[model samples]
Target: MAMFSTGGFAQHGKSKKVKNAPVFSQVVYQGDDKVYNEHPLKAGEFYNPILQGCYPDPAITRKGDDYFLVCSSFAMFPGVPIFHSKDLVNWTQIGHVLDRTSQLKVHDTGISAGVYAPAIKYNPNNDTFYMITTQFAGDFGNIIVKTKDPFKGWSDPVKLNFEGIDPSIFFDDDGKAYVVHNDAPNRGEALYEGHRVIKIWEYDVENDQVIAGTDRIIVNGGVDLAKKPIWIEAPHLYKKDGRYYLMCAEGGTGGWHSEVIFVSDTPKGPYKPAPSNPILSQRYLNPDRANKVDWAGHADLVETPDGKYYGVFLAIRPNEKGRVNMGRETFILPVDWSGEFPVFENGLIPMEPKLNMPEGVENKTGKEGYFPNGNFTFTENFTSPQLDYRWIGLRGPREEFASVLKEGGLQITPFPVTIKEVKPTSTLFHRQQHNNFSFTTTLKYVPKSEKDLAGITCAQSERFNYVFGVTKKDKDFYLVLERTERGTSRVLASTKVELKEPIRLQVKGIGDDYEFSYSTGGDRFVRLGGIVSGDILSTNVAGGFTGCLLGLYATSANDILVE
Candidate 1:
């Protein structure tokens, strides 16, 4: 994770070697000076999306020594998967607050609609953890749940009189609180488009009601800010040194179109954009190293206990075939101040994937497992006793997707579900470590009958992804790599590799590219293609927390033979 120099472009199979990485060696003296270095004055530990699979909009709150972060549970039963972190990195899934649809009855919610941007705020006054979300379909409403402890049962979710999506709550320096969100102006008013008038209003946290009426000032991204460039949505308010900053993402949440920062002095006012205004455009996500172009701008600010500020924005690491990202990933940057202004000294900076460790975690030594010869490795038994934060699921997660084998190896069952129907199921995964990194899995594939491909996927979304596996077409086995991008499939490579025995699959992913090969003998590796690279796309285009992921996937035209 430490860059010795701001280095080169590509360097062999290990493209994970970061390029042009700036070393803040001067930071050794700058903090005491008035003007800090523009880039990485003090880079906190880098945070990879641990809850990668569909965990979007991570609202993090710290209470005492415990840190709580939750993501939107879109259409998942256990709506909001709450996570606990300390030192703000290396998180483990504690539990989900909304477990039953009974308490969260969004029957009318679309296939992928349920909980929207939930701000987790712990009120120490009564020691109550308050969770609020935009209930998109049931009544198209705002709801609140209160619990003395998050791990315990939550009280009933009381719907607010508000109507909108991506709802967030801002509790001021004073005990005064307010719930702010953009309503579907397209639905209610003159039947205009949805991005028309995005406004902010006050709320009564005590009574779980709206203190301000529908007539609130349009903070940004209405006809006014909308004219600037990008669609203004997902607004959150923060007062830094008396400068009330209302920050929101624009240009929609997909592609490099996202404008990270547009600020305002008043919660509702002539909100101004940061000079670094289009604060975090993905124009810099190098096309060669990153497969997808660039994207992931929806963001919120988080300040550490040390009063250091950082913006948690999203980024996409593309896969091969150049499909856009399927999910958005959470990225961080340090903010330098120019008088009262919050400047993105490093927001647009391409974060190198280095390991800046948290202060408390005792272990920095990566766990060992099966790895070819590289910097990254995957163990049979996960080094982390629980689960690695690097892994994320579609929604929350379930134990059924996998379980720990008693023999000290991770025994993965064939989860036949695809990206569309996995339903937050446990399909343990890790972010692609490099624009190019090889992922190989040695397993025995026993077809239940025919038409089953069990293997690994450089998967972004159900539509935009690829997999390499063994399929029994007519009782004959063939090794194949199927590219599934935007609901279409083109076989990249297929061969009649008879299954006289079990085989191992290897995937070598380089900057925006990959190679899928099969090893029946399991001694040496073969090149499936001439170094197939992927696009820089990720699920962020599809909307979720995480970059493009190298996930283990298995599917069956019929049932699969367990091996």
Candidate 2:
């Protein structure tokens, strides 16, 4: 176990002075799911969701034998989590692509308003990797960053001359580069609510800019304009056997989501949609089917070293209550590119829980340094100089408020900002990885006033969340539980307590019910608010692109009443 202590202090807007700051000793997360426990992995089978828990909008690329994959991070600091895989089955998080505050400017934005649909591709012409995405906040619309070696560091963002989201770069075989993205129809060409178009521009490789006059519409209104398709985004241009292929995600990111393909003779194309249409989808399947996986789309394809093609896409697995709390996850499926256009092998049908591993590749997941799937447990002691990549902050970088104490443990300097505000708060967040899980942390501190509080926060966004912590009310110390749903906050429970030693706080989720508990000295914990509904922590109810976040939170502007 590690220990922490605070020495220096400062005052900020509307915050009161405090004597002792809160110190966190450790955090442990354990996943216990009935489905995963019953259905164990066989000899040659692996899990379907290679990268689980809120890792959405996957884009993949390969250079020689190495494959690099990236996912959308929204407003989480150090945006665009990147992963490395030798075999498509096993993956390891190398680090984030945007790891600096100068490169990521989402400081005052909402949790779900920063980065959207990041596309990563390798351009062999210059031996560099390009990551392009739209920053909905910070006024940095459609930016691109380059890195010669992804293991090192990335360049500062260069704003692109585009007006839309999901921008992707493609380097043709003849050394010419082109950029394709999702944009709205020209001026007044709107046919329906979700009517969108795919546009292409000739990119200048030397100047890193798209030619101003070379922009044109590639696929208008998706597969068939007559049907008026919705959200034709995440476009990628690929060339094989003297033909240019264009792929995109259609139908919104909801139940009707799917992947469609188009073909043309040139990069700038009057592209033709494939006759088979939806190359990948789970929309038409039975809703109550076993091991349900829905909302599958936003796919990127890559050819493995052995010439076998596979696609990394985003999908969701709802709980028994038919609610999505874990958010969209990264899933891999073998692609059958031997046909005219690439099609996800088992994509159209009801998705299975396991997939057959590639030839001669052993499943080293949950062992080695590879990312873990299925049921697993993660514990952090906060003793090392560098924090693990799994721990991240919201809106701003974690280093701005968190420090690993010289003597050990982690110290979070409380900010005046609370979790209810859109600004960055003094909180370190980790994604809620499982529906049935437990998160526990031990804290050592005593509140000086009612304005100070430190504990755990289970947040879906600023408007929908739960805060449970220790606060000073009147002349006594108390533990309080507050619930915020759709912007309305109310204290669910509160109890006076004596602060003589470190206290253990925990939150457990069993299906749609969530319970908060605490312990003072021993392992026995008393439940604080009984079982509360987790409906607000779900995307279906919270209305956002992100999943729930488990935050080690501390704030000087605490407002939960203890009456």
Candidate with top TM-score is 2
**Cα lDDT of model 2 by residue, 236-276, tens digit:** 99998999999999999999999999999988988999999
List clashing residue pairs in candidate 2: none
- Count residue pairs with overlapping backbones in model 1: 46
| C-alpha TM-score for every candidate | 0.69, 0.96
lDDT of each: 0.54, 0.89
Clashes of each: 46, 0
Q: Give candidate 2 regions above 4 Å deviation.
A: 1-19
Model 1 agreement with the true structure over 209-288: per-residue lDDT tens digits: 77755347555343244254445667777778766776666666555445444456566566666665666566655656
